[model samples]
Target: MALSDIACRNAHKSDKAKDGKAFKLFDDKGLFLLVKPTESGWGKWWRFKYRFDGKEKQLSLGTYPEVSLGQAREKRDEARKLVAAMIDPGENRKAVKEARADSFANSFEVIAREWGSKKVQTWDEKNNRSKRMLERNIFPWLGAKPIADILPKDILASLRRIEERGTIETAHRTLQICGQVFRYAVATGRVDRDITQDLKGALPPAKGEHFAAITEPKEAAELLRAIDSYQGSLPALCALKLAPLVFVRPGELRAMQWQDVNLETAEWRYLVTKTNVQHIVPLSRQALAILLELQPLTGHGRYVFPSERTPSGIRCMSENTLNAALKRLGYGKDKMTVHGFRAMARTILDEVLGVRPDFIEHQLAHAVRDPNGRAYNRTAHLPERHKMMQQWADYLDALKQGAQVIQFPRQA
Candidate 1:
């Protein structure tokens, strides 16, 4: 028999518990709340179960009196509307809650992994170094914490720890990396804003220390003379000789490949230089001679300075290789480093050789100006530069042999 509201109200709970079977009552024509008995010392439990979209779903509207028969019917109608639209109300509710949890649970390490895989494609060598330092120092300290929960105080504390070790530069670098990570978090919608912005000027400034080098001309002459007598391989000897003539950064010189050099044309093309511009170094006669001698040994390899022991070719010469070679001739970092060759050339070529500062700066791959008062590729002076390079090398050679100094062109 179909139940009525009067019958549902009259249906009282028996003293003993009933199992499996439920007391069913209808508040309307097709809607019902089934009250089932449990042996767990509770009065009874009610579930509003109905069919929607050819599927059955139950909405637990609470025990009888707590959720009246009328209220259960209303809840059932709302759930039916969700099902009519092909939506599972129960599952949809759970999904919303889970998404909220995931956003709150996002940590620095988790976001960094995503950034490394998806976001770091355009990052250059310098950016990679910054990222590496962050992974090594900052990540281990605060990576697991939720990005949202990280405060300015927490960041300052982390930097304070790094500063305690007396690496002021490292602290600054770590903060920069941290700032980038926070910005990445913002870009991905993980954080609302970067807390690292407040951290600017918060940490102690790094000491202004120039890269160690030897700037004296006579000392550089001795160093060049010693390099000429180096018992190393021909490529190493040639790189050392060209290091002064070209005055390119050591990494740039070591990374040079045969494809970049044009021996017949007396030019070396740098496609990707430190300034992120194409650079062309016009080779001097002395530089060409060095290349001619090196061609037989490392000409077939990919790198101009290939490691003698490896068939796969050198990825890069060791950073310490040039410094160690200098050490062999009783010179330390201060006396004459590989990089000092640039300073020596820039100093002498300007003061002694009377080469225009602008020309010397351009030849040294430093930023310089054009006739239009705008920055231009200094390689435009290649013809004049070629002559200047040969003259510079000849002058250095004369100084090494204790010959009388030749008059240089007056500076414009």
Candidate 2:
């Protein structure tokens, strides 16, 4: 006879004084609910009993009430199907668990971390942009799955999550990063092909937005002179003083930390967010003096330009702060941008100063390559760049004093 729901509810109720002895009520086939007496009432565990590999084995379906009689019967019938095929259901469960654990060991997240750790070492400034992207967008969704098991759809799903967040540009970068990982996986023999290759043109294209810049030296000199005479907060003043000197991306400039600077060495080192590369900016004498002057004021906080708000002082200034200060100095977004500092330096360094284009690109944290087509490590050409930075700073000072523009012969 089949076990009824009422029988399950009252199971072990009749055996309270059995001194912790357990009993079982069998349903049709090999399914039964083992009722164990507890302090409050009873613990009903549904179990399926069977024999396989010339030995008896039992598998727990689930607990009663939660599992219910109907559900327990369904589970038992599925397990019976496995046994009928001469398979061991108990061993099958263990095999499935072991497979999952193996997949985790060979997971995309694990491989990505391995590749990033090695790649970040080659990249100076220890900028782990790949690691940051994996953690933020990819890991949460696709981290644990086996790298071999991840299909193009899985990659697309993760990329879409980033796209839906309105970070379409970041979504594209994330896809590029994924492609790198897949290539690594291919090289390592983990996968036969790069799955991200199948995702070409899957995402909508991201439009480029270029910041306005004053490329002419005479115009830049006027802007530099204005920055010098502008009245502003000490941080803003120091920022204005050093902006044209270093010409780092405004976000990198604003988020500059005290710990990454070495006044003795005249260097400002940090990870550039856009390229995810560690960048070293050789500070000019003028730039160092401005820094040393601002030290006594903002040296106490995490950021060199700490936010004015209480408790938020750990963070850097708001994005609009520098542009607002620029606006106050009469150079609106259409005329000049904080990012334009990079463009100004790029144009002048190559066209006017005759600095090596490679050095200029490296200083700007762009992807620079050697004649052999390999990226120069972080410390490449440091001494020469150090000299060039000082010269650039001196040139700016001369411009501020209304000196004539001196042009150097272009590199052939």
RMSD of each: 12.7, 5.9
Question: Tens digit of lDDT per residue, candidate 1, span 240-303?
Answer: 8888888887777877889989989998988544566788888888888888888887888777
Q: List where candidate 1 sits over 4 angstroms from the true fold.
A: 1-132, 142-158, 174-196, 271-273, 307-311, 370-373, 406-409
What tens digits encode model 2's per-residue C-alpha lDDT throughout 231-328?
A: 87888888878888898888788789999999998998888777777889999989989999999889987778876553445667656778888999
TM-score of 2: 0.67
In candidate 1, the residue pairs with backbone N, CA or C atoms under 3 Å apart (3 or more residues apart, or in different chains) clash, namely: none
Indicate which candidate wins on lDDT. 2
Model 2 clash pairs are 125-278
Shift of residue 383 alpha carbon in model 2, Å = 5.5
Q: Cα miss at 29, model 2 (Å)?
A: 2.6
Local error of candidate 2 at 215, Å? 2.3
In model 2, which regions exceed 4 Å deviation?
6-14, 17-25, 35-43, 104-110, 117-146, 149-172, 195-211, 217-243, 249-260, 269-280, 293-338, 350-362, 365-384, 394-412
